[model samples]
Target: MTTSSEPRTEPRTEPHTELLRPDGSPVRVLVVDDESSLTELLSMALRYEGWEIRTAADGAGAVAAARAFRPDAVVLDVMLPDMHGLTVLGRLRRELPDVPVLFLTVKDAVEDRIAGLTAGGDDYVTKPFSLEEVVARLRGLIRRSGAAARRSESVLAVGDLTLDEDSHEVARGGDSIHLTATEFELLRYLMRNPRRVLSKAQILDRVWSYDFGGQANVVELYISYLRRKIDAGRSPMIHTRRGAGYLIKPAEAAAA
Candidate 1:
């Protein structure tokens, strides 16, 4: 399998929806692939979405990991060194009948896709696929399988500022605010940890999913963008701690 040639530096601004289990735990996923690099890449991407991930190199390892991990979803590679992916799928279904499975294959043949679906995969993606597509597919699968549920309050509020995870809406003091996908993600992260400082390294790793080789200017750039929309013409809630990082609090709390 080959990795996509697309640049990975830019932060994914997609609506950052946090899916959790009914008990408010991270969604668990098991990824099965022989390529260590591919599994690592996939693990990083999924973890950024706030899902717990475990990986296996072959069919036996996949089954063993699934038995222990009890994943809500599985990303199964069609070609395994020890066994065909279809065999693995059958074994998985027997144990977790309702779990969603997404098949990854190097083959683009129609028969291959049909065979995977016929064997009970919930979805399919060919190799050289984008990480964004894989994460999106897994999100959908997890949601549909009844494994993930919207939090009791889909909206997160810190004082007057509110963010609706479902609608991707942001507002301050009853006034509507607009944000780019990336900006929304940044704001959400800040609001999620109100009053706590988050370092640039932490922000870069969680928001962008990788290190920028010590280039953290992107964080500053996006923070500026958020301040413009979220704090302009008002008592600022987002604040920088010089060398520390950034944090968000209520306007009243900051004033106090």
Candidate 2:
């Protein structure tokens, strides 16, 4: 195993041992990676979130764990020793279609990131990642999943763009817009605050989490992602405010 040159802050030793679901059940998470130490560290941090965690060091073990533990979410490593991460993801999807997955990979290539998401991952975090960021991402995923399950609102709209929280659907001018969990959350935040300039810091805090200590560049990356999917080939609704931040508004409102 190769060691990262990046400085490692000592991982928080104490776990949040009492985390539980709304019904008083523990939030279950399966951590999959060949690196035992990394999995141990992640398990500790996630247990801090009051989640019950099960660990798997290889792809087959990951699938088995997911099936037996019935986790609400999965933190998966891309390069597993026994099988590829996406292969494991495929098996997990077959068993638990709606369970949100966050992919962890060492590569930062665009194609690799796209492939992971295209394969049904809800979010991607590159390695050398902060445990705080992982926890924040998991929190966001679980929160959104819970919201989608419980939301009473039928729809949210800012002009022609519409998002149905209960249905887990989005559309613009009658054209369906497919979105991953993270994209849906980010757009939901923007639509909830239509026309208001949201700094990257604010977006990160709300859409990601206040606990996420990762770089602000991830905000920029996902914003571009939203533009391509939501605004492409149409009158643009997502606007960059240069150094100020970003905003989503009706096209006419932006032109005004």
Model 2 poorest 10 in a row by lDDT = 14-23
TM-score of each: 0.62, 0.53
**Candidate 1 — worst ten consecutive residues by lDDT sum?**
1-10
Where does candidate 2 stray beyond 4 Å? 1-19, 147-256
User: Could you tell me how far off, in angstroms, the CA of residue 31 lies in candidate 1 after the best superposition?
Assistant: 0.6
Model 2 global lDDT (CA atoms, 0 to 1): 0.80
lDDT of 2 by residue, 95-210 (tens): 99999999998888999999999999999988787888888788788877772222234555666777887887999888999999999999988876666788998999888887
Model 1's alpha-carbon lDDT is 0.85
lDDT of each: 0.85, 0.80
Q: For candidate 1, lDDT tens digit of each residue in 35-98?
A: 8888988887886665678999999999999999999999999999999999999999888999
